[model samples]
Target: MDEVVNAIADPVRREILALLRERPRTVSDIASRFTISRPAISRHLRVLRESGLVHDELVGRQRLYTLDTAPLTGLAEWITFLRSPAGWQHRLDALETEVRRTSRERSTTPDSTAPKENTA
Candidate 1:
């Protein structure tokens, strides 16, 4: 999971993953989307391949890279755990309290900034 996390930490690598998600692409196809050099894109692809986030298959003279999301299962679970209802419930309760407090203060505070009524 750490490798998967680290692999996707780079914005370029994430974009590569998005491209793979849409469809398999060759190194040239992936490299075309970024301003970075082909070697840099190759390095990113290496990291992704090592992390099992992508799979490459040689089709005749070209290699096509495809996304393999199985490795992200653990990361997904960790995220779901982090965003559990228990944690969000407390946060929502606190937000509700703060909102009510702010509303009460606004209602009670002086309306000095209020626009004066037009006297025809």
Candidate 2:
């Protein structure tokens, strides 16, 4: 569970994992998607690989990277544990996540029926 949490903590690493979901990609290919240099991307990938969320294979001169879902098994178990009636923390966290997402979506679009506040 610690590995899963750490692996997902960084937005860049998460994006890298998302890219690996579609298919294997070379290090350079993954680096091209972001503004960071290849070495920075390598560090992120290293964390992911150490966390068991990704695997790499040497294909000629380039390394091919792919997603490894095995670590997710532990995450699923953790989620199940967190969803139990005794786990109020998880419930609150889930609610907070939903609220944030809803607020973000609402902020992007105008609600025609809503009243405008005038502080004059």
Candidate 3:
């Protein structure tokens, strides 16, 4: 999970993933799309592969890279949990209960009013 997060942190790596989503490409093919050196692109691909976001296969002398997408399932699930209605409802209910308790306490307590000054 940490590896996935770290790999996706870079814009270049994200672009590489986007390209893989369309179709698999060799290291040379991916490198040609950007201004960076092939070595740099290779490094990015290495991170993506290590993170389980991508997989590669050797076709003859060339290695083609493709998106794996399985590691992303956990990230999707976490986002879904945060966006759930029940999660928000629980928080709102707790806030409402606290507000009601405070109001009740205020109403039950005797007022601490200052004495009024007598008029001349």
Candidate 4:
């Protein structure tokens, strides 16, 4: 999970993942899309592969890289959990409780600026 997060942290690697999501492509094919050198792209691919976010296969002397979404399932799950009603409700409830507690405390506390009653 850490590896996947680290790998996708880079802009180039995210773009590479997007490309692979569309379809598998050879190293040269991916390299041609960007101004960066093939070696740079290769290094990015290596990171993606090591992270288990992508897989490669050699065909006709060309290595084709493809997206492997299994590793991404954890990330997706985390995102879904964050977006769920329960998650927001928990946070909102905590906030509401704090607000109510503060309001109560303020009401109970006397205002020091209030005018005092004079006894003739």
Candidate 5:
């Protein structure tokens, strides 16, 4: 998950991922989208490669980068866990609703055990 987050943290890297998600692109092709130098794009590719977010293959003289997409499994798992019924936010909301319901019930129902106080 850390790798996935780190890979996506950079806007350039995210753009690269978005591009490669559609189709594999050459380093030069990827570099062309940015105003940064080719070397700078190479550095981003290195980070993406290390993060397992991308993979490269040499096709003849050109290196083609493709999205690996395996590292995203951890991210998806985390999102799924957060969206599940066991998540804290959902539990807190439910607890709050129950408390409000109980409060409303108490407000509406007069206490039978206590003596009624006279209103001025």
Candidate 6:
């Protein structure tokens, strides 16, 4: 999941993914639309492949790349969970994650204690 997130972090890589999303394209087909060198685009494609967001197949002499959206399912669900505002429980969970991250960074244990049960 981190890999997928990191892969999409770059605008150039995001554009490559968008191109592949439409249809499978060869490296040249993808590189033609960008100002970067073909080698640079190939490097971006390698990152996408490692992240499981893209798949490459050898068709004759051409290597075709296609988008694989399966890896994005978990990411999409997490985004949806974070975006929901109707559930206090959902918001609390998100807050807990942020708090724990902060606590870990500061090496403090403010949240080490268990959360009190809500009986209201």
- How many clashes in each candidate? 0, 0, 0, 0, 0, 0
TM-score-best of 3 and 4: 3
Model 4 per-residue lDDT tens digits across residues 1-120: 789999999999999999999999999999999999999999999999999999999999999999999998998899988787685688998999999999999899998899999988
Which residue pairs in model 1 clash with each other? none
TM-score of every candidate relative to the true structure: 0.71, 0.69, 0.71, 0.69, 0.70, 0.71
Model 4 residue 14 CA deviation (Å) reads 0.8
lDDT of 5 by residue, 1-120 (tens): 787898899999999999998999999999999999999999999999999999999999999999998899989999998778776778898999999999999999988989888998
TM-score of 6: 0.71
Off-target runs (Cα >4 Å) in candidate 6 are 86-120
lDDT of 6 at 106: 69
Each prediction's Cα lDDT score?
A: 0.96, 0.92, 0.93, 0.94, 0.94, 0.93
Evaluated against the true structure, the overall lDDT of model 4 is 0.94
Better of 2 and 3 by lDDT: 3
Q: lDDT score, residue 88, model 3?
A: 69
Residue 36, model 2, lDDT: 95
| 41 Cα displacement, candidate 6 (Å) | 0.4
Judge candidate 6 at residue 12 and give its lDDT. 98
Name the candidate that leads on lDDT.
Answer: 1
* Residues 1-120, model 2: lDDT tens digits: 797898899999989999999999999999999999999999999999999899999999999999998999988888987777576777998999999999999999999789999999
lDDT of 3: 0.93
